[model samples]
Target: MTIEQEKFSGGVAVITGAGAGIGSGIARRAGEVGMTVVVTDISAERAEQVAEEIRGAGGKADAMTVDVSKPAELDRLANEVFEKYGSVRLLVNNAGIETIGYAWEIPVERWEATLNINIHGVIHGVRAFVPHMIKAGQEAWVANLASIGSFGIMPVQTAYMVTKHAVQSFSECLYLEMELAKLPIHVSSIIPGQVKTSIFDADAGKDEPTSTARHRQIMHDIMKAGGMDLAAASQVILEQVAQNKFWVSTQPEMTEALIEGRIAFLRDQAPPSLHESARQLLEA
Candidate 1:
């Protein structure tokens, strides 16, 4: 039972991290598709601003502040949405943070923060919203945002990669469980290749050793130069969501080879180093 794009009309979409970047792009697109969009973010002001933009464009939208890392806050968000809207047709767990540094060198606090937001955030959303969705007996979809780094590796980005890999695994398990239960709910793991976003701003500003700082800067530059536009990427993602696709890759051609290479390496075959090309591009 695949959901068509028209099914989104008059539905409710709750998007976390909708204040900026790819999350904001998805919120705006949801509004355009005639869904009542809930723009949620840790930053109240940014959430409000995105909501206002949607409203100004003659779309129904509301803003809510939510720190997805907090389970209680996610519960509150679910309650508010259910009380006001009665149903949520789309739940996007898109809130995430990035930390840079080797696994051993990165602070424990950073590791905890990344795991809480990137992995636990998705879990909290599922725990809070899935029951309501089932009770409502509505066809719904949950899209958990992962990254290419989930399958590929990069130096000095252990924390971010670890969380994304977890998201990929969790999303797959959720999909399988839902399928076995014969539920109307669908799950998708969104694997996005560098979309133009401010995800690296903190890394860029970090007070790191010169070598680490330079590496971070290189990554920022690469993303800025080669990343796809956020709106375009979000459109691709939403289309896949509507079709009930399990694996949503925004840049498949670029990522497929890397994923294949990883598999080959795991089989004890010679495979191209995942980050070698990225490093070469940066040097060039």
Candidate 2:
């Protein structure tokens, strides 16, 4: 059955990276339907703040500090959720980081950190949560955040792009595995182009973007020109979850680009034709 047709009554969801951005939006949407939400993030206070907002709005929610890269943290978060909510039917692996640099300029440390959070974060989240979720034998769902970067041969994203592509393929494989196991679990990957979020602050620091740099300004412009808002994307995600769609995508305008990109990869031809703004984006 479709995610919506299956209904979310009595289900529980635990979302990582819920302090803000797409993760928070997803939590809010799930709460709107009266589901129990465990809002988790590396930032403990922010996660709690979001949880408080949910409760203030008459939704059941709990906040926990969870670093997706840490298995112990994820395990503790899941334990707390099950202890309180009794069951968990959803895991949103949304904690991610992007380390962008020219292939030569990229630091191994930074690249690994990105993978620790982006790829391994998803890995740890699933490893720590899914076994328990399955052992509980409940109908559940897993949503891993990928990106359109997975499709683009866009330059400079390097490790970030590689990790996202891995996420996309990993999610698909998990979905099929669940089906083969005859388990009542659903898996999906989201490949959004650029949602209105604070992701540009990836290196938000005393140095990198320096916190006061033009990071936000650039991200804002990107979202305005090349991205969609979080709310709009969240609606599609909820709809997708309800439908158990394997791929949740947006910006119909980019549909053709993604299609052609995939076709090129399969035929061992050139990467898909670039978007009109590809040059400008690549230079960015």
In TM-score terms, which candidate is top? Answer: 1
Off by over 4 Å in 1: 1-4, 202-211, 269-275, 279-284
Evaluate model 1: give its lDDT: 0.87
lDDT of 1 by residue, 28-56 (tens): 98998889999999999999999999999
**Candidate 2 global CA lDDT score:** 0.77
lDDT of 2 by residue, 208-252 (tens): 323223433455467767668787888788778778788788664
Report lDDT (CA) for all predictions. 0.87, 0.77
Lowest summed lDDT across 10 adjacent residues in model 2 is found at 204-213
TM-scores for all predictions? 0.93, 0.88
Error of 1 at 225 (Å): 0.6
Q: Give the range of the ten consecutive residues with the poorest summed lDDT in model 1.
A: 202-211
